[model samples]
Target: MSPSQPEVVAARPLTGPRESQDQEGAIPPATTRPEQRAQARDIVRLFQCRLCSFPLRDPVTLPCGRSICKQCLPESHLRLHISYPAVPERLQGFQCPFADCGREHAVGDCGLDVVLSKTTELVKDNLARGKAEAARIKMSTRIAVRDEWEIAGIPSLRSPSPTSEILTGGRLVAAWSMAENGQLDFDAEVVYHGMDGESDDGNFAEFEQEALHQVQEVARTEMDCQICYALFFDPLTTPCGHTFCRSCLHRILDHSLYCPICRRKLAMNPLLNRIACPANERLDLIIETFWKEELHARQGILEAEEIGRHESLDVPLFVCTLSFPMVPTFLHIFEPRYRLMIRRAVEGNRMFGMVLPKRAHFSSDREFHELGTLLRIVNVQYYPDGRSLIETMGVSRFRVVEHGMLDGYTIGKTDRIDDISLEEEEALEAREVTPATSPQSEFTTSEHGSPDLATQTQAPLALENQEDIARIPTKQLLEYALDFVARMRANSVPWLTQRMLELYGECPDDPTIFPWWLASMLPVRELEKYKLLETSSVRERLKICCRWIMEWEQSRW
Candidate 1:
């Protein structure tokens, strides 16, 4: 029948005994038997179709763990085909009927639930037998009361009429007299003999216990993660109407962006972090309700794994170019392995390490430099074909202690590297201070009336400049680096473009960060610039920058 035209099973009134009791002017004892029956009927309602409110005909289980009759399943459509032509052409299904569980499902993904079907049949049979037995006992009670009234010489009151009603009222006094003398007590007890059947109660109780056990078993089987072969922990449902543990799905996506069971393409956003992909709330509730202890155990295991991951310092590594702390790095991720790595990083802590590739002649043992910058993902834009452009900012410098390859990408255990504390910097500067000298005095004047950078190193003034730089204050060092950037921009240096300024921002006011910023913008070789990562002293990095600027100016001359 159509869902709107539900076939309701209305409760049948207690006809025989109730009618007889009313005619005999007898007051019946208040019993909870009817209320008990109503409760049992309500429990049976669980087997009814959610759509039609009738006993399930062919139960089908949705990915969200709700069961509905197959006939009640919604119509499938070709919407997925139109939206994503790359996806294989097939009829996609509809959302679950339950309001709390609206996870979309494909027609092919939902199938008949054999266990629920058998359990439904058992419930129907038990309900039918109970109703029939109650009816039989009720009918027998009415017949026995009529026979006892006839034996007591009371006029037959089977038919309701004016005469019968009057005679029944008159016979009520005689009936009570016979009842007090115990003439009607034996028949009354015999009429309710069937109600005390121990065998029937025992059989029904057994059936109920068995049905409950079957339902629990079905729940356990359904809640298990196919990949892990255990109760689902943090379950997530895909658009294809398949549910899997969140971790299992993550591992699956690393290999292929398709549903493992249906082989259907999963629509996923690489930029969407793990928090955005929420677990199946309804399915999680069901799993918890059925397997609370198992779920807790699974959670403990996951927590332990998380703690171990942190203790090991394991992190994904992106080995491509040199990156410095506080600098922004833009990457075009197209390779499959790197794509997977980016997804995992975004989903996880949104952090990964970026290091420059080691030259083939430099090191055959390792492919990348040990010193690298830890990058935190800032933003990500994805293409329809799985390509993505990600923006990340370097958080800190790290040294790879140990490294390995995973799914074609690099992974490493790293320790963070920080510049010396302010106190340490002050002490070093104080110990290394020398007499001050003007920077202009370091260069010799050429015929063009400008400083000749090439001859500056050979002049006596060059040693004075070096001595003054060693004792220079942090503020003065920053000023020198800023002045060098200004000169380069004024000279219209090829690498120092407006875009570069906008990208890295004008040289920072902090002396320690200034060196890394200038070093990143400079056209110096990566290996030469790699020195910045090795040094802990800010003054030392500034010295390296000064040497680079001098070499560039000398080269121009």
Candidate 2:
């Protein structure tokens, strides 16, 4: 890995360091033991309570630069909708008394552990809620087995159709992402549930209520922008129902209609700052309770298994990943469990599996990507507030053979892949590979080798066809792969951008040139990345990668 690589950079590249200097605590030192030690010490400082003389024992650092114990930051423990770190004799709750800044950090030495618990809880709560709702839909409320109340092919029944239906998400609470206005919004997602082709809107007021309640908690600290990694005070949400710090998200929206996370169409109002919306409060309450219960049950299973017998451990349940070159999980505050994940990856094997969410139930439907990288954990550091800074290097690419939702997380059967050739590797080593980066070169790379495929309009092209495109060699199918990236846009390209440059030396601002310290970023989808993870033969893997890139690019572009 290149020690010179930027820790977090956007596609357009980040113009500045985001977050309080407290976050700078996550940067790890150079590989040397002494430097790493110094960096670790510096990182540890970020976890200390800046306001108090003590270290943030059970660190829950608020956006207001205060840290508190998790017990002190209970969800409904607030006396008023405000945050005050110093618990006063008159104060009944841990809520920060500050007006707009109401939430103080939840304190606890599980400090890092607590944050991980929070994230895992986020997933768990969602999955459990989904299951409960499924049970509701499964139950025949009126002597009919109907997850859907609307009758198909008949106009008689007034039916409420769901706007979206995921087979199994832990809790499946109403997915009210932070929108342009308010904290969340609601929509009627409908899906066909029974053989009768009947569908119904699954919008529940209770679910919306759950969202609002959580927002009250989430609002206390505010969120760091997903893009710039800054505290999201007065955050702006997109039409796609995704939120980001206003300035960070707008930069992308201004250029094109794409979600910064998945590059999908954000059908949202650009002007919305905070949307006041409704949720099914009653259902949300019931479902939220069930979700917590289920997570505890699952955690119990893991604990009991550890004490009794070792089950088939190789079967990877959750496919966590840190991709090379891109920081998709940017500004994501490090939680404890994830911190544990980083520790294991660093100490045990420096390896972790890259898995994809099922195509149907992912955060976005466009997320069941065709390719992805089995990124190796490269860097890990703890911020003073106990959040972690982590880096993973891309080692292999993967393809999804099949995908489905298991328990509540997305699951898939995957195979590993490689797409670079001996010659291309030599070229990359020589730093001789070039990009048709200009609009003219971009078009030329696409049309030069094709006899009848000319006059096709193009998108803003990044990266290059590392191969000599004038000829499509029979043995080197990877050439077809390079051609694939030439025409990709939105979310259709397969994984392996940095690798393409590494083997062929055709990357932008080429980092892996000649004697440089490291390779550039390798971009791929979760499945493609998973495939690379599963593959053993490097040569055959390249062929598989080439085929996937071509297929994905061909489909979208």
Candidate 3:
């Protein structure tokens, strides 16, 4: 390739660097192809496999700067971790499993064939812009310094009348039980000076002071939630040193009974009276710390609102599941968090990013993705049952790098991603490939001569010979299956609608239990699903589906 001519680059018109910042994770839409991989460096920013010298096939890149074919990765590790049954995400780091590569490294994961095609001119344009940015940063600067702080003693309590002066203090004894039932029972008592107080405010105030005041001594004990948010009443400490409430565990497990924190097997047996609650000393410290933290959070916001007297209280945080290309691609794989996410997205334009957790150890700490789609809640329907169905459409896609976890939701720093095309339909002419007259004959030419794909055929389908079927691309095959599934399942039977959709994109006209047939051939492990989830472009999905279908057929006969 010829080097970029500096004069030509310099002369080009400029759009500001801010305009060019990446707004989405690197993944091309379904339109990209391999032939472009060699020449489309300007358009594609995705990671390529280090071993095969391949550019973004099933693109799996890790933060450590290596790439691998997501297809080749194990289903457990091969697919995007988001749909891998625990926490969900589109791309995740994969280890280089290259034969005898002999290196312990990870590549930041991304989708292959997911980016838009750009020309050499675009690359040169971006490079020139980048050079200008670097020059600007170097030309301008700022000084940095460490922040200072001051620690202070607690303020005196505002008690009414000093009353109960029982035993001044004793060790605060506390015991907690994790019983056979879900309740986390706790018994806390403080051994303090003689205590006698009336129920009236005067006495209640004094007693409250003595009960809550600066406990003469309390150890600072804090437990980090393995998932997001502050600890609740019933936190379960895991063997892997992670702590999450039973609800959080249930949330992550999706009822599979696995630990959400570490993706490890959980103990089915219940814990009985697991440990002693923080002693009186520890309890006081925790309460005080919590109070301080809560106050700190509300301080600035409340002060402003109090002065303005016109702030709305709808402090909703973005909480949804799928993000970006991943969202539309995996619409059928119904996992709980994401199901809730999509439902919530449909509630309005305000949607949040679903950031992949930086560390599984602290996934539950209000952790969330930054810059997400403004999921407009387009439809909401409810019946006699308590649950409601929500439908949403993406307003804008965003990339959130420094994501911040919010209580009860996910929020992140986002840059909006522009869509080249929305849910626009590409019309296909009425070729009329129906079961009755659509070319459903065997090929005189040995099956497998479609230009884009070549499947090894052990048994040729009579329909394979049909002239029209012989010319279609892999993408068209999916569209056909999708259309067929929708037509097939137009009626009853919702038992495994999601499963069927995952297989063929929709319920078919015949309502046949075809997923079982499909699953019988493709790899049925969790990891296989992960690979399917990791796929970005429609073409990649088609390729994987084609390979798996062939594998399935080969496995049988």
Candidate 4:
């Protein structure tokens, strides 16, 4: 070496007892390859709890759209003595711990971020595998170099010649090469010879592909809804840190107000609708980002099911009593089949057809009357024994075109019945009115002078007056029905109680709806009241109501 050049020292490999001492001595600080460390840091940044700075455990997404670990939540923000299956109460203006997100949050508004949670597990597994692989590769390199020297007949304590090359399988395993800086550098490569002649790099690549496939499979399974056992179409997270499909949750709520997984009571809210609950936007975004094709396929399945439901006219039937449009119907559902029907109705559309059961000894293809009303469920309260009290409002009238049995309950295909518009009725009446020159008017005027003739003619004249009464304007008819309802209420009629008023509301001012309201409270045979559903003309319905009221008054007298 020239005096002006820097002296280079050759690195020595440890061996025998010295190597064992090096391994047993003070442990070196844990280290990872640059790329592995970077990957680990990225995962920590993404999924670490903001409060604890550790991998998330039971991740909860707050109302502000940020996620954190549930265990890291401030003690002051949690309700004391909240046991298992019962979610913590609202945080009551709890402030977020994140520096960039100091927004207020309520614990009630938070739910487990199922997709994020699963992703965290995947990332964590990747990190752990990376660390293990790096350590294994490092240890294998040391062992491979020692074995190569031993196979070459080199003593453990002697340094090999700089020019000497150790070979395995005719490939250089350990060697020294000249660097551009006029120094010799030691280079060692470890290769695990396999029966298939595959290089370590190729084996590692295969391992990596298999690991990736496994991770994807796990992710797919994690994204599935527990109830349906399929990929989640519209996922909803409950307050108890459980996730389910929105439709699945609706079905669950219809039968019981508790969560399917944890059995926690689900508080009724506007977000929970008859058909579906509000979807988890965060989890949905995660699913869409990673599994776009699968999610689309799942959504298509749901759409096809919905189409089939509508095309088949698959409506559940409650064969109990007579119901009319714009009227409230209360039901005490106790039978197993009807309870199942209510659950299915609530899960699908919250609607079912209400019909009067066919009279005993009457032979018919259907179990109920053909004319019926469609009732939309407004609220449902479930009991411990699976019984429920459901409040429903009549939506429209329908006539059963076809009917069948389903799960021991009646199902119907029906055509909706709507009343003729007042304009149409008025046009028909105009065309039917008699001209002033008609013989009927002349006969009435000519008989007015004879008392004996008038006496005999009074009955026919009264009938004519009654017919004229039915022809009154809709506004006047509405006024007459309102007056009758008000008078009956003033008299404190048994059926017209305060509770009934609260349920059905005060008599509606609309003429088309007024008749149903009056008839619902009337004490008459349901079969007799079924006439209202059959009538299409509002004027005729009012006439029927007027006659019913007359008979009721006559019976009272």
Candidate 5:
């Protein structure tokens, strides 16, 4: 009641502890106090709805025994499309909202928590009573202070809201809410002075601003992509705990299939790799919470870069051999850069260019022949040491228009090549002529149409834009090519022949393309194969292959 003294209210005493014991057959025979049990129950009640952070309502327990608000569960749109049996399978991938308890839960794993529901009702009762008591006390204090301030010529200040007041002090003293003689009291000591300093509202705004600044700083630093040295755009965290922007990780993986920061091998099959590392859902959530603007900006940059990458679509090149259309090529990839190249190729359209080396060089950007074959992957077998043996077949030939290096591998802008065909008149005229004294024409014909014999309707095809072309019968061309392959002395020739026989069945129908298959199976030198590959016309390619086989036959002497 002193004019110069601040108001004080008597403080409430805490509840006395009552000893308790667990059930007789309990596993641990644990001892607890009533106060301690109550405190534990209160702690559980304070846990907010995992999705919305409001007090949990209509509690639903997960398989992990943690409860969340039923309304907080994701919408069951999946049930609309999924079969009843498949519902469990589909929900098996649903992530628990609780941090560090990120265990997946199936729809079958969730049910109403009856015990929690009862506990929630008790908690609601307690909260209601506490709020009502606090409001009554606050109203009484306001009336008493208003009258006292008017009598003492002191200005009356409005009290802060229940939430703010509790956040500042009531919450700190909440443990002292025990009742004595059916009454709760609060005690305080204060120094009062005329209001001449910064208001509490201004101080609160400054504190909020500082907290936001701190959060933004931490988010930017933690979510930065190590490869690009920028905020993560479409961030992906490797199994090794390192995160990077999806595009940056791809660029790094283009050179090495390892974590760019730790250099640890990423656990992935080179033949079945992905665009980036596995996603970190927890980190993604954190980034979205604190750095949404940065994430949006990063997405914009990534979208622009994606458009740029496609503007001039570049095909990765393997400077190894002359792959022809429809011919299977098996590659043993061991080099780090090539392993990355194969990984990316397998992940993407499963296509790449196979070219002969211009010279005996591996790392040089311009070391590959201008003209190459585009190959489509068929299967891949991985080894323990991150190496891979991939099986692919040539799709079409291509001429490298613009070549460059990305990371360490060769990439080229290419134009696909197609075999040239003659005009209808020229084709008919050329078909009338047959070669004399050619090895292909020497096959003896039989009534049963044996593999060695030429068909009666078969004829040579005249290629467009070529002169002085030697003509060979289509059936004879296949016979000669198979014959040339059978004469090869290499150990791999038999297997190659078997594969070829299995695929084309001893001979391919298209005479223009048959020579390339023959060329692929032959034990000819790389240079010879490259020369044969460069030939545009079927007749010219056949003549060159025939002369090479003849020379090889003579050299065998």
Candidate 6:
């Protein structure tokens, strides 16, 4: 069958004296027969290690003018030789392993042969890439054959035999050329010939079964995952050259930094550096092209998972500090993982959770607080660098139900929390009131005094309960609250009052919403404000905030 063409790159020449350098074990010119002489330009032979007779790996040169593979030398031979243990050691030397060059040389005097090492590395990398490409081509062909047969209403095909016999000549070669040039050209025409006349139609079922068996054998070798032993979904490759499903790899990495199959050290750093693990792009492309049915099944499962995540309130979470409802939170996002998180947030609901970071000593899953606020993106300003300054406002409170990690950031399923209401009791109490004595008329002018009287209007808003606050006219309550706030040290933080005036404007008209404005403006601890946030009653929130303002007013004396 036609195969993809290999790339051609000009090889760099060795800088040493090429004319003098020969194969390490080459016979002397005086003893060599005329026909046994080496070629004029055989650089590969000249750089071959003297000990292993192969391309050098980490080459080191001996003082005796010979080079060998570092790994090829015995471990014991790497150390300096000491003749007597009692004597103080002043000299360190190495013994050459070559038969004709069994000489002792100073250990520290030897150096790495950089030119030889580089040349060998180039040769080895090319050989490795060639092998990988060949395997990829073979696997791709099997996948293509199976996919086409299934599509054509035939589940039976020989292991690559049907493929080769159908497209054996110029058309197959042209397809290969197109593929090598970065085009997917698998639509080559195939001619069908009727079954041989000698064979009866009765035996077709048995023949078909045999062909199906062969197809399964080839498919099992290529389609099954090395880790899960099932069809691959979201396959990824490790630096150690082993492939596994993305989820399987993530689970394995949670315990260790080694490949599951080879047990090779897959990473030099911690498992948190998962970004270093790269996608197996070639393998992924092959599967997508050839396994449409399997991919559809995988999609079905993923869609179900997405439905479940939504039920659990699973959105991306940002762990940093406390945020409260109706307050603006500014964020400086620069981390690559958070950049991806922000992009997803902006694309989806434009919402994410903001939770405070937990202590380092806690478990990874416990790295954030249970309580968090959901923030809605207001605007984002991008900088020349990839970093961004995002403006957001807190929308609601939520408690995490389940936590999961996506890519490098945190995500969680959460249940939204709302303020507990006094509506049931208030409605029952309102229904019990008599229609004869109206609620407003019962509050005589004597208790509330005249609207213009400073003595009645300037009373502390903190002492008023929900009913008492509601009894006073809105104009009188607003004036009295403003006078009390102006008399206290609450405005000591100038920006607090300035920001409140800028955002909500002077004295909100709605009594129920005024508490939130006052809470946002008060210079209080986040924990205390969070308590106010958790409180369900607007009147209760106002009482708590006013109490704190009065306390601050007393402290000023």
What do the candidate models score in CA lDDT, each in turn?
A: 0.58, 0.34, 0.31, 0.56, 0.49, 0.48
- The residue-by-residue lDDT of candidate 3 on 1-557, one tens digit each, is 11110000111122333112121211222121222211212112222233433332443332222334456453333221111111122122333364533222212212321111111123223333433533443321111110111002221332222122221111110000111111211111111121122233243333323322322111112333446554322444433334454445544542334656456554322211222111112212233333446434544544574555323322233443443321221233144444465555555543433333323456354444333444444355654543555544433344554443344344444443432110000111112223244332222222222111123222222223335442343334454544433443564335236674563443332211222233322334533433433432333344454444444345632
The better candidate by TM-score, 2 or 4, is 4
Clashing pairs in 5: 9-186, 9-187
Instruction: List, residue by residue over 1-557, the lDDT tens digit for candidate 5.
Output: 12222222112222654323232211121122222323321332233344544445776655443556788775442221111112222323356677766644445435554433543455445544543544443311110111223234342433321111121112211322221111121122111111112224244234324433443453344455667777665555443335566567655643455777668654222111232113444345446655678778878887897777656748999887678876678889999999999899889989899888776355545777788988888899999999999998776677888887787988988865544422211232245334442322343334432322233243343232223224443334344555656555245545365656676445554555577777766667777777765765555566676666566666742
lDDT (10s digit) by residue, model 2, range 123-223: 33443554465455542111111122222324235333222232321111312111111222111111112111122323322332353355334322323
| Cα TM-score per model | 0.41, 0.23, 0.25, 0.40, 0.36, 0.36
Question: What's the lDDT for candidate 2?
Answer: 0.34
Q: List the residue pairs that clash in candidate 1.
A: none
Best by TM-score: 1
lDDT of 4 by residue, 354-467 (tens): 999886564655667899988989999999999999999887787888778899998878776655522234433434343431222221222322112232221111223345
Comparison by lDDT, 3 against 6, better one: 6
RMSD of each: 25.1, 29.9, 29.9, 24.6, 23.9, 31.5
Clashes of each: 0, 98, 54, 0, 2, 0
- What TM-score would candidate 3 get against the native? 0.25
| Model 3 spans > 4 angstroms off | 1-359, 362-374, 381-389, 394-398, 415-472, 475-536, 548-557
**Ten contiguous residues with the weakest lDDT in model 1:** 163-172
Candidate 4 ranges beyond 4 A from true positions: 1-313, 360-364, 429-465
Top candidate on lDDT is 1
- Write down the worst ten-residue block by lDDT for model 6: 81-90
